[model samples]
Target: MKILTIQQIIKNIENEVVFEAYAEDESFKIKIDEYIPYVCAAIHDGGQMRDDVLEKCSLSTYERWYEEDPHTAEFVGNFPILIQGCDSRFEYDLNRDPDNAIYEEAWGKNVWETPLSESQKQRSLAKHHAFYEVVEALIQKLESKFKKCVVYDIHSYNWKRWDRPVPVFNIGAELVDHQKFGDYVESWRDGLSLIELGDIHNYTAVNDVFYGRGYLLGFITNKFKDTLVLATEVSKIYCDELTGESFPEVINQIKEGFKTAILNHAFEFIKNETSYKVSKQVNILHNELESDLIKIDKQLYSLVKDFELLSVINPINLEFEKKKFLASNYKYEPQFKYNPLNIDPFEFKRKLSNIKVEKINDISIQNMYVDTINAYFDKVDLLANLGTNKFLYNSLRYFGEPSKKDVDNANFVLYCPEFRMEKEGEFNENEVVELFKNATQDYGFQFDIEVSDHIASKALVINSKKKVVIKKGVKFDKRFTKGLIEHEIGVHMVTTMNALKQPLKIFSIGLPVNTLTQEGLAILSEYYSDSINHDRLRELGLRVLAVNMLTSGKSFNETFLTLMEEYKMAPENAFYLTTRVYRGGGFTKDALYLKGLKTILNYIDQGKKLDNLLIGKTSVEYVDTIDELVDRKMINSPQYFTKIFKKHLEKPEINPILQYIFNGIKD
Candidate 1:
């Protein structure tokens, strides 16, 4: 490949820049080589206005920037043979016909305060003429080497101004001979539609937002009979148009993703192109199965919600010693006596395994969908066995305990004790209700809260159902309100609302492996709200140690003694910690808070986007998989976002003291 200078880059361009031949101009950066059979050009990317026009133009630099293609260069960056204009379109728009190159009025407003003199007009037209001269040379070079050549004329549009969801990409073919290349064009759109940028889906269409009627496409098609130009218009969904800043990741994703797909389609076109189709029924079936899964979630969680607290707290005011002994001796059995499993896991698994994955666009992805659903059903079976020895055995099978790394990470908690001044105050339930109502309004979330005797915890949170049942007679502390809202509503309820925006029910309920991520995100939300206090951290630390003891087969008395004596926790608080782990057949779920906090904090430090975590019960483990679903438009972005943690900021360094407190396990 060679880079050439514009003066030196006439029709028969040649350059002697070492590794190859080339003359170069900033206005035109073309990577040309031995008959590559195609060229990718972005003609509207320039925004430099000539000094002469500076006095004559009425628009501001930003105004012209708003109309310019900011990242078209990134989209076509990787092509071996490329041609892109570098001058501002305000100087001359190569895509427009020669006479219209310098706009008299652009879009709707007057572009210039005064019309350009003949010399200035000729100057702009001369550059336009020079661009086509090289384009024709490049085309001729390709046509002589191969029988035909194809051009991908790339540009972007402002889609947000439109009233509806438009295609992420639009291929304009008005100027192309669709009679010969229509199938190839549609195939290209289909493949582009499958391209993804993180969790954002790529929706592509043909002749939708723009028909390929640009002068560049017309000139090439009319002059070169065998040459085809696909006028591709991608919406600036890949960037914040208002800010004039582009997402490099998205730019890279498309630049790399489409490079090969475009080449593959072209090669196929060169060899009798065929068409591909996607099944509409598979999407319907996915929706139907999701409905079935939603029913299973209600049954599973309702029974297990307060099982840990209720079963462990003896109603009778027993002696302190007796309570301590009973805490360890707490025995549980199958709970089908009250809450029966509505959907049998075994049958549910059978149904999911029977799905015809081959019908989906990507079979492996479809299989993952099945596996994730089956995982939820597995949890349902485990929930059915809650309070029994059977539940403990099954809990091990589904939700495993924190590993050594998880324990080790918990010790590094952030030490901002002085920052927790709000913890000193107290408030009543009415205050709590008002506070929650105010917090919800920040994100525009809708829900109801009430005080109730049937509730166990001070705040019995049922976020997925948008309900927070406050235990009657318990005075609510004002300090707990914000953090609790951040935890329960910001993280949990916000995700529930976000899930509703998605097409699948799994997001609405939970991803089966969601326990760790869900709790972790909840705790993280508390921290983001600045409501995290040492007391809350200590409570989480105690739960971690308690769960570790249970998983290691320590009796409740052993765990209780460790919390009370070694950790110096009060007797009542120690009992609460013991039961939290030993309930639900040795539930190891509580350990996740510290584990989740550390993991999520590390993820942010490593520069990962956290929005993926908010998309309806998504686990950090399945982010890539969930992203693929989101890219397919099978899921939607979070509709409800947390104001507390609007976006992840730079993470503070891990606190070794806090880390030691949580992740430490004495052998």
Candidate 2:
């Protein structure tokens, strides 16, 4: 940030140069990331008073802070253009007109024991004049460049002082040209109502607590006909109004929610003004934080690749052990030896914790990046504990254990007569590889196919390496081959390819708990392709049951016996299922397949779009943020989509029994 004189600031605006600076006198600050059509101003967000002025004032420091709009600038700091005052409003309120700028009394109390001298009054008024001069120059430049402008005049009020219940947000718009921009005013008010600040339910109304009577609004509205100033105020719910202690978590939530609401509101304003045709040149602003995020993402990717759980957890001598366990009459547990760890788990977790997410100007992006980093922390911890007794605890921390509802739902599906159908296949592992190769060709992407004896599943995709591994001797039913291809190549591989093309590498690496959404989407693909059957649905339910049993402290032999005797599963199939849950000391991720499917089903039932969800390894919860990023052109749409999803889009279909089963499951 640079310090520049008023004339230099005006010259930079006139030249359309982007910069961040403070006025030479240090009365205010301005940051221009890009000269967009909107501006954010926090005129009363300061409590700094000159020594001379402070000496004459009768009010204490707490009194001054009570009247000032603290942290108001931070609420809209993510915007492209921002200007905020740094001097105490008690000296000369920036929101008041110049004629009455210096206050003699405030909030029905005397402001000074001795009135300020003529020289002191002139000094305070000079800062006020300089602030409006810069504001005029800014609006002039925006109107000249974009033909219209919107200003978010941010402030905060003391809600506790009111005798009656008041709204969380109050928009003062009485002084604006409502006849011309009445819809925009109402839209802004409605947008504020969407902000979620922890336990505080947001309530917004126009001209409820205070009208738009500030000098800043009057000055801008009178000077620029094309400009609309929205006087947005938030009650002091984010802090202890009486004690002045702030709740950081609540403040963070407010900042995150406010960023999305204001940006969406601004985009709508511009779309309406430009007749719904936004120019490509109007790009989202980027900063140094992008590079910082990329560095952290790369570090996380490297750590994850070194700790692929399947490669480390699957036993090398599986066939020999299976024969021995069967020969011992299923009394002796299988002795499993795992592959060596490439990196120490403790050291890996330390590295993950060391990588910090810096404070980003864009609150929405910052929140996403922060969440991704925290998710990585849990992932590294889980990976470090692989093959140990502690692994189950870490797995529970990362991938939560199935609830009683999940177990009941799984048992329901297992017992349902409609899901008892079974079928046989003639295709071998080699034939499955050939099918995958052809499927990749049709999808316009290439992935290496190799049959390996180490993996436990029939086939799985190592998305980061762009490779598919098939179990060496497994057989796949010919009817299920197409659905398997759609599951791996169509959904997982497509999202991987799309994530690799993103500017931020975190998408390619995957988000926290992305496994749940990714697996759910894959199953949905199979259903849409008409390859899903009752047998497949039952298998998903059994996996959920297996996970629940393992989490409930059932031993490998106990779980295997229950599956073979009680569930009527084949001996060999029961062993495989038990091994899947008991591997790496009680893995519990299998339960997510059923839960995730239900989540996706409910998401689609709400009439939400899938294009955003398919953009990368993102979850259903982040669809709105992805859509916002697409609107801002920060990221592009997915290059490859599930053929089944596209077909479903044209003509949607779902199995009646599948819908009934999921609809019966409780949230």
- Give the number of the best model, judged by lDDT: 2
Q: Candidate 2 on 1-667: residue-level lDDT in tens?
A: 6899999999999999989999998899998977778889998988888899899999999998999999888888877789999999999999999989999999998999998999999999999999999999999998888888899999999999999889898999998898888899998888788887767878889999999899999999999998999998889998999999988787788788777677678888876673334543224343334445567667767666444555667778777778888888899888877776777767776776776654455666667766776776776666677778998888888789998888888888777766525575558988899889998899878789999877777778887678899888877887678789899888988898888777766677777788889998998888777776776777888899899888889999999999889887888778877887888888888899888887888888888877877878897666766776777667878878788899888987877776676677636
Write the residue-wise lDDT of candidate 1 on 1-667 in tens digits: 3565565565343331212233343556665432345667888776766688788999888888888787786666444466777788887888889977878888898988888899988977887887888787777666665677788888989998889889889999877787877777888888788787788878789888899888899988988877778889988877787887768567666765675466566656544421212232122112222333344434433433332222232222223333445465533221212233455556655655555432332322433455565665566656667557787776666777867765554443423233344546777777777877787777787777777644324565564457766655556555566778788778877786787676555565565567778887887777665565676777776777777788888876777778788877776567656755776567776777777776676677687877867988778877876765555455676777765676435544434544454344322
lDDT score for residue 333 of model 2 = 89
Model 2 alpha-carbon miss at residue 657, Å: 7.7
Off by over 4 Å in 1: 1-358, 411-423, 452-460, 472-477, 631-634, 647-667
Give the TM-scores of the predictions, in the order they appear: 0.50, 0.84
